[model samples]
Target chain A: MHFTSEPRLADGVLEREFTLGEIPGILWTPESASASAPVPLVLLGHPPLGLHKMYPRLVARAQRAAADGFAAATIELPGSGERPRSATADQARADLRRAREAGEPVDEEIVDRLVLPLVDKSVPEWQDALDALLSLPEIEGPVGYSGGVISIGIRLAVVEPRISAAVLFAGTVVPRALFEEARQVTIPLHVLLQWDDEANDRQAALALFDAFGSKEKTLHANMGGHTGVPQFAGDAAARFLARHLK
Target chain B: MHFTSEPRLADGVLEREFTLGEIPGILWTPESASASAPVPLVLLGHPPLGLHKMYPRLVARAQRAAADGFAAATIELPGSGERPRSATADQARADLRRAREAGEPVDEEIVDRLVLPLVDKSVPEWQDALDALLSLPEIEGPVGYSGGVISIGIRLAVVEPRISAAVLFAGTVVPRALFEEARQVTIPLHVLLQWDDEANDRQAALALFDAFGSKEKTLHANMGGHTGVPQFAGDAAARFLARHLK
Candidate 1:
């Protein structure tokens, strides 16, 4: 990993941007953390709109995690942020446009094309990020994952034993294979669903939640649109993460 | 609707080929069917491989319906049978090949492009065919739908009140929107699922089944690949159609 900027101190938190191989990411650690007494880590799943678009939420969530004595981080998902556009991404954009214009549901295939590569590329990058973050004296195990780009969260929760718990956002589409894989997830999960999300398939979201084999899974459904998550819901999710990580 | 050939008589059954506007179709009527004593009608959802490829299944299904004293019919789905190939179909084929080669799920966009137009075109066409068939004194209401291309089945179940019952094959993918629309369906439904279908998304199929609003729906899951549905399952589905249509 290559640090792109000097660490900045603010509000008792240390913040820095870095590139882990080809993946861009941001890391936030509470200033009070030390090698002898490490804090649990939380990896945030960046929404498809990229980190810049979601900066405020990312910062807020990370800050909340820091406030709760945990380190938080987020990586740029493939096809988002500063990554160069590829043919597949272009096709996915066109497909989205056509589906929207037609008032049709986005094709599952289009969704698979858009998300699977990100899951394939991002999961390993996240594992690497976890490795680097955990190597720091101030960041410890008993990790938690939070946010959208849900396929990544599902993959990480399944494959990365370090992610002890997950708070999954349901605004994104879940591929069928992911649903199959979800049955293998045995960790605690806190899934947030905006019940009236205009851009989401509510049934698919419910189905994915049902597919999780985790014995400790909770569905926090709120009445709103895709971004209409209430503040309390976030707090509740953070509390769940805190309970598991701590 | 224009009949392209004379109705042929065989084993107490009558068969003929016809065209509805630009679409080609086939109709079968039991000899016992007459103006004074009309028989219930069944519209078959021809599979994607075209009527020629599905001819045996269609004939057998129609024959079973006929023996059960119902008129049965099927039209070539758009992009299937002898329909001229288009750029969209070619792109979808290429996309499917790429997805399969990569051991990835085919993007929902490719599926939408490949199947949605067919769904759009076929539903109204099937409605029209229903109109023409019902107009014949030998065919009557309390209709049944059998087989698939599942999107068409979901649409027909939702839009056409003439269809009182359906036997839906779960071998195809269900688009997210269809799951929402499925909630409006109230007809008695018998869904056939090949539990281990190699190409089918089992979770999606289950989700779709769960989304059906029909209070009288039954899921008949068999163990096998897409075509592994056994003879007994078909007979059971026919029995279901018989129970509702007769």
Candidate 2:
């Protein structure tokens, strides 16, 4: 199933949708053409707290990237993101399954239109977005990615070849039962794990990091608890992107 | 007048007090080694809400540092690190007058410490602590320091000759009308500023950093709104200390 929507402007940011595989995602772009050149694209995958608008820093990072010659875009997954368009629980479950399999999730939330689904098995949804992203115009190339709380999103970004760099803030991992594909990915990965992340979530992140046998992986253990996309994270992400993408 | 307190332990973390000229401070240290080897000391200075218990990650940082052959501490400015020891309004005001030269308005709510008689302002409290620290049989020659929220503490660390390195997390400045001593410091300073810091605090930090004027200054604009210490500041602080001290 494919879903699409007309691009809308909230405040000044642009919100649009495109198809990735069989799923669709809301694309958040900076309202202004502030980039000095064809900037590196930052694909932001947010968490599923319904407070997608709380990503002021993400928006700010995008603006900073624009200021620093980088383009930024945020994608909403199925069952969350732009508008809640889920037909039923079965549809939600099916969307989740597809996301896990295809690496692209569906989006069906109506709030903020810029947030991500919070689940841990939406790899397919992410892939769908990645596929769609490659098809977008004026997006530049060689993407840098970041996410808050969404472990699956981090995993997707890390494993996906198109993602050259990634900063996972308070990341977690999918249970082995969910995705048995836990191996080392070659992409540069920076995991900013909050010391006081959710007990289970912390375990998940540790396990995932342990499973990731990449030599380039760096873990920054933060003192503050689970702060999603913390402002400090923006600078850190920028540094990571600079190191990996540039 | 110099204020001092014997080193004590709270929750197994080392705690002490000292006078910086006329200002008093309550310092908290992690329960690590006091061996002859120089250890990294992270001085945590809380927000204007006055000093509360040290944040958990800070304690953890201390623990990690201790494990990594470093010592960590948190200093409560007499005006605020500990909640219960703040001076009364009249005594505080009197101390401010006696130590602050002449007419100066102190924010009692933000900086109220247990009132005390005025002490001489010429004596450097941080230098005094260094003297005492060097005097300790267990302390070695190399020393490192970092602070947060309390701009004065960071200044104290920066200007002192013994402090080999410093990281000031979410620091603020003293109004020139109150105390303008931060500008004299030249140290390897790393300033961590919260993105959403409170009114004038961000500006204060920028001003302080500009004053410190270290060639190695690194400014990290974090995502948290006025929270002291970003999620990953400890790791960065540790790296900073390691670089400068060892």
Candidate 3:
């Protein structure tokens, strides 16, 4: 699991078309890696608010992971993130169904049931795209997802054993029970928080960290409102991935 | 329209409940008033975050207006300021329909077509509540509505003849073409904007003001971002209302 700084594909990152059940996703792969070696991959999620396009820092985090020799991909959720906005949640659900059908290599049961309902609940489709991307073949075991407002995805990581690690940033942990379940996760968990966040998403992250009860957990404080993945966090995430994977 | 201070309603502001269509709203009316005949009113509206209960500043603004010899009411949008989370746009629309059906003496057609759709679009429902409140018998002519993110409400005022004067606080304005059909409003308009507002809602306000083609339009700059109605703004709004209405 030693990630080399060399390209596994062409460039440090390569965008390849991937399917999660029926969902189509573009995978960002490190060109320097070996196919035989098990690689740690992450599915970076985004919120609705059309803020998906605004997440340059999260995209860069993926690049940093690739540069550190981990396979990383930023997937646009169905009907979101360079995808057209669906007039209704039903239409978005339909698109999600198609994506689940197409994206076979990943866990469709999670995508169809728990994940879709969460996405339909107005959690934002960009988050769903991350889930779809993680289902791809190039990124199977030991995955992580990151977003400033992605609490549900954290919950997903807790329930799905496939997720070996998770990074929750300025996001809330909901239903309380989700935190209890997340505590059962045998993988490393990290959260980046801002005290200035109005929604107290940072507070929720702390609660989750408390529940997980593992010394492997880390919390980084950055100044700003509840949006954007700070570049300052990129190096920390890289080191954490390297430690956990290799 | 000269707004000045009045006596306390009770120990503080009196919470008034009114039905717009079928939707129920809690209006806080500040008892502080200057014994003036037929006092002008300014209806303060809340955003989708919740009901007026959560917005202390908006309630305070209404109280300040009432103290300035103007009757002020901050009405909670239905289904908002009520629960843990604000109601969705569609829920607000259903409430709008109920408000109209209840025969609350509001502009039902406007509530049904324009205002409801706008609220459903997440533009904010306080303007519609203001519209209904302005049409009430307790309110005198030359009434206005003010708030941050006050663009849609401004557009509603531009089209609806009932709104005689408006003081936008750190507000943004929608495109003039949306309000084009009802162009010739004789009332005065004051837009107070901040430099650090999201996406420069102030600049958007300026663009709308420029397109308005009215000499009476005023744009003032403040030092805050997405601020609640400031105390000093009460005097300024009072002055504007007095100049236009008296």
Candidate 4:
């Protein structure tokens, strides 16, 4: 991991722009954090909207985590943020639109193209970032994951032993294989679902929730579209995270 | 739909090789079927294995449907049977393998490529075939759909008013969007699930089962792999069709 800049944000929170090879990311740390007494870390997974579009939420969530005495972080997903988009990605999007318009099934292979690389490239980058963040004095061992692009969370929860808990947003499309992998996730999970999401498959979300082998998993379903997650839901998720992480 | 050849099979079952546009398919009818008094039809969605590979099961199911007084039929899925494999299909398969090996999510777009065309091309072809078969007066309305390749089953259930009931196999990978489409399905459904399908996402199967808007949808989960549907399960599924079609 390469740290290029470090800028201090509000209330003793420090934001650092860094890169793990080609993947760019940001890490936020609270002022009271130290190596001798490290705080828990929370990794944020941005929604389909690029990181810039989600800056407000990312900042807010990170700030909240920091204020709660935890270090927060996020990484750019493949083809999102400043990452250069590939022909494959563009074609994949066209295919999806065409399939949706035609009311046809998107081929599993095409779906694999869209999600696999992001998961493949993002998880390890996030893990490496975790290593970098944990190397610092302020970030501790136990970790938490939050946000959309749920495949990433599913993977992290399964592979990354340090992640003690996760708060998963249900709006994203989860690949079929992930549901199988989800059975391996044992971390405490708090999943938020928008029951009336125009783009999300409610059954898929519920299936994912059911797929998680986590001993402790809670589903919070609310009425509305993709962005309709209520503040109270977020608060409840935060509390859930606090209980597990803190 | 055009029929090029008709041959008599055992048990007074009649098999006809036909084409809807350029797509090849087969249709079967019982000995008792006649233009004067048509029987109900049952469209079969063959598993990923080619028609030849599934011929025994197809023959058995069609025979059973025939014995139960329903015309049964099946068509080649894209890239299966004698269908010409395209470069896109090969690439999609490679992409799926690469994603799976790397433990990554298949991009949704890529997934669209894999499934959309099959659903788009096949559903209409199936519908056209239905029209032609019904025109013969040997196959009446109130059709039933059975077998795997679930997306086709979903689309048919939602859009085809003629189909009164369906028996859906749960081993196929269903696109997430299909779950939403499934909500529009009001046909009586009997879904067969192999609880331990090695190639299937069990949660996805269950989710699809839950997504069906059918007032009467029954889930039969058996303990086995993709091809592990016991004879009893087939008997049960056949009985389900008999109840609705007969």
Candidate 5:
């Protein structure tokens, strides 16, 4: 891992930009974090939107996590942001867009093509990032994964031993294989679903929530379309991660 | 209304037993509540399990409400507690138990017979208690209705204009009529569902949640059986009430 810049937010959160191999990412740590007193970490996940476009929301979440005494970080997905795009992934996106424009249901095959490969490639990159992040003296384990591309969160929860908990947003087209993988996840989960989300199927979201094998899973379905999650819901999600990670 | 007792809980909350006409009830207020600075009220609802049976759970909820600077109260359901029982209601309960023992789905008519009359008789009693309770010097308006006998909560949320918010437990046999009434409830709501509740219908609960008209509604589904709602859920409900009631 190599650092490109280290800029502090106005509230004194240290925001560092770095790269692990070809993947670029950013990390935010609270001002209080130090070698003698390490903070728990939360990996912020989002839809395959580019990092520059997602920075505002990511930074806001990072700030909230920092306020709750946890460090937050996120890396670019394989086909997103400045990273080189896969031809197949781009073709899948085009198919998804055409389906939406034609007012047709998204094909399951299209969803699998678009998301499965992303999950296959990104989950390992996240673990690699985790390995480097934990090697730092100022960030500690009992890690948490929050936000979406929930398939990745589900994959990580099933495979990654370091993640103690997760706050998953039920907003994506979950590949069918990931639904099967969800049954292997045992960490505590806090899932957020937008009840009237036009971009996703509500029953599918509920089904994914039910497939989880965790003994302590919570689904918070709030009244809103996609992108309309209320403020209190976010607070509740923060509390959930804090309860498990801390 | 008559106050039969005014003992203080260990935390200094004033617990008063009262009766309106012949319906018995209890009211709990924080020590900080007074005529000069009264607190908002939450009308605690429960199954027709009698006050004697529900006292422990009710008082714990009341104490927590008092701790959050709100007065809490509850009135016995029509055929519950030390109150006189109805033969028709008794028959319905018998049928319900017989079906459960027979491993058959509870008939909707049995549900209606078992719950509708209770709702019809209980809602007005709650309203009357609300009137008399609000007339007290230590209690104020901007009320909240919380806990179960969910059909009653649905009715109260629809009819009672004083209730500014509600935290309804989706753990009852909701009458079909109330599902329609749910769409008329525009107040902010927080509905809790025990996802694996042995005695409740999960799909019915989800359908009812979808029917609620509250634009600011939230559905919190947690892993547990009927009586296994995790402690964090209670805290989350308290926070929801505090957000709207205060």
Candidate 6:
């Protein structure tokens, strides 16, 4: 892990841009963070939209976490942001987009081809990011994963024992292959679903929630399109994280 | 309305039993309640199982509302509690019970017979009780309806303009007839569903939530049976009331 840019402070939070080998990432910690009293960390996950595209929302969430006395971080996905893109993945994405634009049912094969490889590649990056983040003197354990590519989040919940809880956004395309892995996730989960998201399936989301192995999982479905998650819903998700991490 | 018992203080809340004609009821108000800054009210909704049987839970919810500086109240449903029972309703209830106990699907007519009359007879009584409760010096408007027989809450949310918001418990049997009424409910709603409830149909609950016309509705589904709603879910519902009522 290497710091690629100077750390900056905003609203009492220390934000730093860094890189793990070739992957870019950022971390935000409260001003009170210290070696003696390290804070719990939350990994902010977003759609394959680059970190720059998601900065406004991610930083807002980071600020909220900092306000709640925790640290947050995120890493660029393999084929998103400035990272090198895979031709196969790019082809699958174009095909999926064309199908959706033409009002065609996205083939299960297309979904698997586009999503499975991303999940295969990103879960490790997140785990590696977690490894480096936790090793920081001011960032500690009992970590949580929040937001999407929900397939990655599901895989992390199942394989990454370091993540004790997660707040999953059921707003992304999930491969049928991930359903079994979803059932293997035993960590406490707080899943958010946009009730009328055009790109998402409500029944599939509900079925995934049922498949989770955890005894403490909640589904919060709000009315609106994909981006219209209400402010109170965000607050409630924060409270859920605070309940588990604090 | 006539006060049937002396007012008692518990946890800084004033609790009193009252009667509207033949209907028995209870009211709870915060210590901060006054005519000048009249507290908002929340009408506690529940199954038609009699107040004596539900007092512990009702008073607990009332105290929670009072702690948030809101007055709460409840009235006996017609054909329930110590009130005169209707032979027709009793027969419907028996038939419904036999169907459930025999592991058979409850007929639509049986559901209609059991739920419709109670909804018709009780909605007016609720309005009358609301008329009396809001007339009190310490109670004010921006009221909320919570818990269930969800059909009553649906009707109240539709017909009672005073209720600006509601937190409906989707843990009871909802008749199909209320689907249209559900669509008519335009108030801000926060609905709770016990996803694993044996008596409640999860898909039907989800459909009802979808049919609601409120733009600000949210569905909070937790893993549990009907009576096993977690403490955090209750706290979240209370927070919802505070946001709308206060």
Q: Using lDDT as the measure, which candidate wins?
A: 5
Q: Per-residue lDDT for B1-246 in model 4, tens only?
A: 788885767788999888877777788999888888788888988865678898888888899988988889888776777887767767876787788788886677766777767787678877887887778878887788898788888998888888889988877666678889999998888787776787677767766776888766666555457887766568767877888887
How good is the docking of model 6, by CAPRI class? Answer: high
- Candidate 5 lDDT by residue in tens digits, A1-246: 898886766696889999999999999999999999999999999888899999999999999999999999999999889999899999999999999999999999999999999999999999999999999999998899999799999999999999999999999899999999999999999999999898889999999999999999999999889999999999999999989888
Pairs of colliding residues, candidate 5: none
Chain B TM-score of candidate number 1: 0.96
Candidate 4 residue-wise lDDT at B89:
63
| lDDT per residue (tens digit) for residues B1-246 in model 1 | 899999998878899999988888899999999999999998988677888999888888889989999889999877777986567867876887789889997788887776677788789989999998888878888899998888899899899988999988888766677788889988888788776787788778877877788866666655568987767567767878888887
lDDT score of residue A154 within candidate 3? 55
When only the first chain is scored, the TM-scores of the models are 0.96, 0.65, 0.65, 0.93, 0.97, 0.98
- Candidate 1's C-alpha lDDT? 0.84
For TM-score, candidate 1 versus 2, the one ahead is: 1
lDDT of 2 by residue, A1-246 (tens): 133677676655565555555444445565653333344577776655332664565566665665555556655554554546445533545555565577543333311122223343366666666666555554667887776544464466556777777776544435453233435455666766664554225545555655554445555544334653344445666767765666
Q: Comparing candidate 3 with candidate 6, which one achieves the higher lDDT?
A: 6
Compose the digit string of candidate 6's lDDT tens values, residues A148-210. Answer: 688999999999999999999998778887898888899999999999998788888889889
Lowest lDDT sum, 10 consecutive residues, model 6 chain B, at B168-177
Query: How many clashes in candidate 4?
Result: 23
- Give me the displacement of residue B239 in model 3, in angstroms: 58
Error of 5 at B122 (Å): 0.6
Question: Number of backbone collisions per candidate, in order?
Answer: 7, 43, 47, 23, 0, 0
Question: If both were scored by lDDT, which would come out higher, candidate 2 or candidate 4?
Answer: 4
- Docking outcome class, model 2: incorrect
Which ranking of candidates, highest lDDT first? 5, 6, 1, 4, 2, 3
Query: In model 1, how large is the Cα lDDT of residue B3?
Result: 91
lDDT of each: 0.84, 0.53, 0.53, 0.79, 0.93, 0.92
Off by over 4 Å in 2: A1-37, A50-58, A81-121, A171-173, A177-182, A199-204, A228-230, B1-246
